[model samples]
Target: MAKNMTLLWCTGSCPCWRAMIALEEKNLQGYNHQLLSFDKMEHKSQQVLDINPRGQFPTFKHGDNVVNESYAICFYLESQFKSQGNKLIPDGPEEQALMYQRMFEGLTFYDKLGNVIYYDWYVPEGERHDSALKRNKDALVAELGLWEGYLSKQGSGSFLAGKTFSLADVVVFPTVAFLFRFGLSAGRYPKLEEYYALLKDRPSIKASRPPHWLEGPEEELLLKEI
Candidate 1:
């Protein structure tokens, strides 16, 4: 039985955005959405902490069952609602395995990018380490190049896993969007640019894009080389 779904999340959180996109793909009826704010420390409120001990923004609940962590929530939704809405995982074991592999690879890219965001961009200017920042940024560029190469190698396909959009796209699209949010040039990586352009206007993507992003200033967190 598909119980009612509820998601507790903050705006502009990449992980939260991932869950939102997944839910959008699922297109479940009678779901609950509570949009909290990190600025107000709403995630740490007693109610949120009770459901998620870590006070994370992307906590989800299906009836009485609580699940934290973004990807887990996405996987759970895809598995439980296999027959509903869009088919994210796709059919066949080989295809499912490939999708899982690419999804984790997307996380690797997210981690590499986070190294720069956490150490270089988020850290205060006085405490920031120039050498470490450059190292992390260089690593991030390398990660971007990796995806660029992967897309190029995949040939004429518009998606990471192939012709159709799948969970791999759900997991990776936000990371690429985040990179663009930080001002990475869409033009530099033509394949990636094409991919982003396609996904950007997707109904799910547009509906789930961070609300604050529509009203906030653009973050220029990367080097001009992007």
Candidate 2:
């Protein structure tokens, strides 16, 4: 619709980045993007909470529709703007089902890894749990290899969805980022290493990488190598 519509951003979070990746891919740039500071708890400000009751980041205000959850937000942007640019969610039941399946798998299969990483490492050392972190790391190792094996046998290049970048790519990038943030590297994980090179170098990825990716101890200690 109008260029005046604002896309509020927060701390370069993965969920937020999904909408951004789609927007940049389709050349839907230059919408008023306001950056919020997670460090300052700006996302919880009344203005943000009004837009999203859950008070989460990645909340989008597109005309009258208020959207939350990364997957839903990305889906809305893709469908509403489908006529405009490169199609992200392609037509056909097989592709649609595969997209939905992979997206769901990301939440169910991968979110556990993300949560453990967050509690273990992202929570700061004094408050972190060493036991939970180790257990989570072990589980993630097993699961990540599962993805590597799947991709190897699937007859594809980098992505889970074959050639083109799709919802799968959007779903996967942040988890990989999160994994790496705690000193986990794709090199140790094999398939992720290959996928990391492929996904991180995308034009949109280049455009929207979160600032913290380069600034903090997590950036230096975890994400830099990935």
Task: Assess each prediction's global lDDT (C-alpha) against the native.
Answer: 0.83, 0.71
How many Å off is the CA of 218 in candidate 2? 2.0
Candidate 2: minimum summed lDDT over ten consecutive residues — where?
A: 217-226
What total of clashing residue pairs does each candidate reach?
0, 0
The runs of at least 3 residues in candidate 2 whose Cα sits more than 4 Å from the true structure, single-residue gaps closed, are: 1-4, 120-131, 216-226
lDDT of 2 by residue, 1-226 (tens): 3474566678647788877877777667877778888778878888788888887787677778877777887787788778776778757777677777777777755666665645544576687776876676667667777777766765546466656678777776777666666676655676666677677878887788887777874633532332
TM-score of each: 0.91, 0.84
CA displacement after TM-score superposition, residue 217 of candidate 2 (Å): 5.8
- Using TM-score, give the best candidate's number: 1
